[model samples]
Target: MSQLYVAVLAIIVAVLLAVALYRATRVKTKADYLVAGRSLPAAVLVLTLLTSWIGAGSLFAGAENAYKNGFAALWQPAGGWLGLLLIYFIAPRARKFAQFTLPDLLEARYNQTARVLGTLAILFAYVGITSYQFKGGGDVLHLIFPDTVSSQLGTYIIALFVIVTTALAGMSSVAYMDVAIGSLVTCICIISAPSLLHQAGGWSALHSSLPPQYFEIFGNYRLSPHGVLQSPAMGLVRALEFLVPTMLLMLGNQVMYQKFFSAKSERDARNSVIGWIIGTVVLETLIVAIAVFGRALYPTGEVAQHPREIIPYTARHGLPAILGAVLLGAVFAKVISTASNYLFSPATNLVNDVFVRYLAPNASNKRVLIVSRLAVVLLGCWALYQAIYAESILQKMLWAYTIYSAALTPVVLAAFYSKRVTAWGAVAAIASGTVVTLAWDLPGVKSLFPHIISDRDAIFPALFVAIAALIIVSLFTPAPSEAQLAQVAE
Candidate 1:
């Protein structure tokens, strides 16, 4: 990577973040810090959601998939398409019944117990999710200048920057920054996608490079590295990634739904999902192409040469310097924007769901504000440490997704879709999902799922077991009161 180009990009990101840091005020109320007082316009909503979802998962893991599977890596973005399809149907309902979080939704539907458990599930995922962004951001810094920045320090720097941003103004600042960075990335990707495609000798030339299997949606993927399908049944795992978590996202996830609550109007919420569908398909298509054709440029073993840096490798070497700088900044922005959004989330939940609800229900808003800020610092430091030391970006991202999806998805579905669920059902689902995800990470199970299937695809089994446990428990027990059903129906 060109030092000048990388420096220019870093300088640009630093300035944007610096501006946000200055925008934060002393918290007048928790609302001021957490949701920007529920006043985001359509454009800001679109941008914040886009950037928040597109980070390490889209750029790094997407590239890694492209490198390993050729065009077969399109599955990652395809999943997004399905997710957006889900949001289209799900978002309006979520907006209509707006609340601060996934737990907020559960509390509305079930009770205080559901809210607390849901908070625990989300924070569990938030920690893991935020940690991976730190992991990816550190990788970007190292890629740009491996000689100067140690990976650990790089991770710490990224984490610290995110912590500072989140600590300030919280989601209010996050929403504004997302609007700016989101537009930059979308426009840059649109301008550069054709350029990369043209440089890769066009579609026909690109087609000449890969084996025929790369074109198939699920081709080259098997239960093992030996390249043999376990069975058509095993393919269920891939589909479930799109199908299952999507159900969870629509039914379970609160952070994105919180955006809906914050939208200036219901029409704004609808348009935000529309923008998301269009932008996501285009942006992800180009990102996957960069990795696919990048392989046509520098196929295997280049990742280890600069594993995290390989993305800039493709951009810097593949595109002209100006375009290279723009896309690289977009990539880095993905790293920072997403991390900043999530880093603040767990802290908000820690304060609202756990601390205020149980620890000090009568505490002053001033005390809540102080604890929220402090929680952001404590959680930020822990996630940064995990990002730097615990595992690779891929590992951290999957661990977080599985833990949260498993723990929360079922309880969420039962809350929104089925009133037959009891509090025990929610607790059972959360516990089962958390335990299964944790156990899946033990040495024996890791050897099976992630290598054969990326964490993107592997978490379905745990997610299912968690939901199934919830249902089975609900089947044997009494149902929640009609009051709970009426709340979710709203």
Candidate 2:
């Protein structure tokens, strides 16, 4: 059975690589390499966005949440659904202001200092995101081939695959391949859930066998010895910790904006959000359902210790041979698609935002392409280093999401809507948010404010400080110049 799953995954990857190489032939200029030459249609944009958003983060971290807390895991994705409603309004605007990277928007709306600081924050957050995709891909690989591939080697192998694929054709490969992977995974997940539920002897068995709280919205709290709920406050707080980061990431993700910029038109970009919202809500709910059902069948053992493996474990061991193979292959391909998108985004940032902008303004097309591929290699290595020390993909996912949410989201959204925000204020906001999020998670800093920072994640305090800086500083300083405001007014 494991061999069958391996064979299926190998074939899927080969097909994807073939497609990537074919696309590579078309990537001649920097625009073709970075944004698919700004030619993606609505359907392509929809699937690519779905694929990038629902990667290892949803498959592993979110599945782990459902395995442990049941249906309550919906809270994590609910945040994104809410954000998508807002994105529907922002997508066309973002496309109209089309540029290669988010830092470009920062520089146009604010100043070069804001651009540089935003690039740093994006690297801090995105490298962390790309790191866990490696870890998650490694987990899926190690789960199936445990006898031969250790998790550590699995991480290195997956990282190399992603780096090569991303460096091959850039967005041309990542965006189009996502259409295939996203559609396949959506169907597999929707079909697998009910089948898994029926195999587990139905929902009645799940209800009877699992804890009652598993069905509840806030399923993460504990009970007292006397059987009373003891930590409702903490449980709600925990849910918010999951909720905030996801909402913020979706709203301000550079990957998403870059995808929008790739659209054929502003209409294509706007239409894609509608498809993305529906696909995201349905697929994410199915993922939580599949994991919840998996928990019922394999209630203990290895899955209990490492709940993130629940989806793959159930697919390999609990489902029928053919279904399991396809499902596992879908998961493997989804991880690759996401890793390529994320790894490519930061590479573009370094090249377009920094290298071309400052270091080599007169560089040729061939030179820019060379630098772009090298940037992918260097950033990918950094993420691989993080993957080596990372114990929990869920923890890393939330940490990265919080950093981007607090540091970048506020400023990104303000750029679109608020003309009064000055360049200095944008710089202050970005710096404060980035610093607070990074510091709040440090061992020494958490030890100092255990009450406020111990149980909670960094989004709350960091976002507060960021918003305060944007508002208070902008009011005291002169408003943004008319030219600066016009830059983002599209």
Candidate 3:
């Protein structure tokens, strides 16, 4: 059975690489490499968006949330859903403002300093996000072949594959490869959810087997880092912790914006968001359901110890051999797809935002392409290092999400909507948000303000400071000139 699973995963990965190699042939220029030459149609955009959005964060971190808190895990993805509503309006506008990277938009709307700061913040958040995808892939591989492949060895293998695939073709490869992977994962999850529920003896059995709070809106309790159970009120706070960061990340996600920039037309970008919203909501809900049902079937043992592995564990132990193999393969491929997207994104930032923008503005397309792939390899190594030392996927996901959410989201949204926002104001916001989020997790910092800042997640304090800086600073500074405002005007 383990061999069967390995065979299935190898086939899936082979197909993915073959597609990537084929796409690599078409990536001759920077635009082709970074934004698919801005020629992706709506369908490709939709699937890539879906694939990019649902990765290790949803499959591993989110599944862990569902395994522990049940349906309340929906709060995490609910943020993305809400953000999608606004993104529908922003998509066409983003397409109009099409550029290779998010930092390009930041510079246009704010200043050079803002662009540099934004790039740094993106690297901090994206590298952490990418690290977990490596970790998640390692988890899947270890589950399939535990004796032969330790999780640590598996992490290195997954990182190599992700780096190679991403370096092969860039966005054209990532976007087209996602079409196949997104379809496979969506179909598998849809099928797996009902099948797993039936195996758990349906909703009635699930209710009887699990605590009632599992079905509640806010959930009844949450487990602290030390494994202590907290009150229902704390559960609601936990839900908000998940909800706010996820929403903010969605609103300001560079990967999503880059996809929009890749669309063939403004219409394609906007239309893709509708499909993206539908696919995201459906797939995320199914994932939570699958996790919950898996918990009902396997209430204890190894999975109980490492709840993050619920989906893959259920794939290996609970399902029929063929179905289990396919499901496991889907999870593995999803992690690779996600890692490719995220790993490619920050690499794009470094090359386009820093290398080309400053170091070699006159570099040839071929030279830029070479540098781009090098950036991918370097960042992939950095992400793998982070993956090696990472403890909890859920905690890391929140930490990364908070960094981007509190630091970039407010400023990104302001760039689109507010003409009153000044350049220094944006710069101040970015600096404060980044500093507060990074500092919030420090033992000494948390120890200094135990009650006020210690109990709260980083998002609250970071976001408050960021927003206040943006608003107050802008109010004191001179408003942007007509020319500056016109750059981001609808």
In lDDT terms, which candidate is top?
3
Q: Model 1 segments beyond 4 Å from truth?
A: 1-3, 227-251, 304-309, 444-458
Error of 3 at 420 (Å): 0.3
Q: How many backbone clashes does candidate 1 have?
A: 0
TM-score of candidate 2 versus the correct structure, residues matched by position = 0.98
Show where candidate 2 strays beyond 4 Å. 221-228, 231-233
- Residue 215's lDDT within candidate 1 is 70
- lDDT, candidate 3, 288-323, per-residue tens: 999999999999999999999999999999888998
Number of clashing pairs per prediction, in order? 0, 0, 0
Can you give the lDDT of residue 450 in candidate 3?
85
> Once model 3 is optimally superposed onto the true structure by TM-score, how far is the C-alpha of residue 348 displaced, in angstroms?
0.9
lDDT of 1 by residue, 1-490 (tens): 4667668776866766675776575347767777777778888887888888888876886677666666666765675577678677667677777666677777777667768777877777888788888888787776667689877778888888888777777878788888878888889878876787788788898789877656766545544445666664554455455435434543455668778877877778888998888887788787777777777777666564544455666776778888887777777777888888788888878887888777998888788878888998999988876776765565565566667777886777666677688877787788778777777756677767656433444477777787788889888988888876776674
TM-score of 3: 0.98
The CA lDDT at 361 in model 2 is 92
Q: What are the Cα lDDT values of the candidates? A: 0.73, 0.91, 0.93
lDDT of 2 by residue, 339-373 (tens): 89889999999999999999999998889999999
